[model samples]
Target: MGLEQIKNEFNAIAKTIYFDKAHFLREKASDEKAVRIFLEKVERLLQENDRKLEELYFVYGVFGNLYRVIGHPKKAIHYLQQALCLAERENDDSRKVVFLIRLGEALKYNEEHEKALKTFDKAMDLSDTLQVRKYNDFIFQHKGKCLLELGHLLEAEKCFLEALHIRKEKGDPELVASTELAIELVKKSK
Candidate 1:
């Protein structure tokens, strides 16, 4: 029918499939399979729709996360960088933060702690601009991880404390406890 109708139809199906959500891959095996299938359809849709940059960005993000979980940090970084560039072009602050965080995580897992820290720092700046304290908490947690890896125990502890404060403010006892454990680890490692 019309363009709007086509978009509505795709959006309806997309919500159920969640092909663009990298987090969905962390669910059960069956769910991951479904996500992969949906991803195939999403790829086809992007091709059929002229490979729109917005759609490509989402696809790249999903693939990037998938690669990361599969232990291919290099591939993950490549795809994530693609998504990051698109997010920057669109000026999607929230998505940019997410990409940066995930990119940092991939770098960390790949033993590229210095790069990871830089990415996390960028995320922190964006989180401040966005006023998302939870994101700051996340950034601090990850930054602490990088610092810990770098043998900066004191800095790591400080970062963990900052994360703990934010988590406590958000009333997430579980997160606060986790951060506390991280702090303990820093102390023990020292």
Candidate 2:
């Protein structure tokens, strides 16, 4: 196969491993072994490709998210940082925002609330500068969680309310409900 064809095939396989199998394991089964298997496959693909492919950022992102699902926040943070570096090297601000959010979540999971807040703030700033409203609610919601964990209840409520407003406009019932629950938690904590 030509080099382009090989790259295409690699990207396809990586996407299936990440979006299909890994997501199913995380959401439906929560099977750490299955996730590990998929993770290893992707890692092997990265190695065989010499990590020079265009999809390296995506593969690293998949690794980070899979680590998160298996409750390995530190590992997730490492991979996410790698993904963010690759995204930055590609000059992909949109992908940078996404990686920042994922990194923030990993930090939050590891109880690094202050660092998570900083990461989320960076995501929010990038999204705003890019005029990408799609990720606004997510940034706000995750930032709210970090703030809540840090005992900044009022700030957390503000972030959750902002997220709720955006999610309501987007009409994602699940997202709206999630923000509402966060808001309720903030209120109860007060």
Residue-wise C-alpha lDDT for candidate 2, range 62-105, written one tens digit per residue? 66766776678899999999889888888888788999999998
lDDT (Cα, tens digit) per residue for candidate 1, span 93-163: 88889889889978886779898999999898888888754578888887887787788989988999999
Question: Against the hidden reference, what TM-scores do the models get?
Answer: 0.67, 0.77
* Clash pairs (backbone) in predicted model 1: none
After superposition, the stretches of candidate 1 with alpha carbons farther than 4 Å from their true spots are 1-58, 130-133
Highest TM-score scorer? 2
RMSD vs true structure, all candidates = 6.7, 5.9
Q: Candidate 1 at 101: error in angstroms? A: 1.3
Quality of model 2 by C-alpha lDDT: 0.74
lDDT computed for candidate 1:
0.72
lDDT of 1 at 16: 44
Residue 18, candidate 1: alpha-carbon lDDT: 25
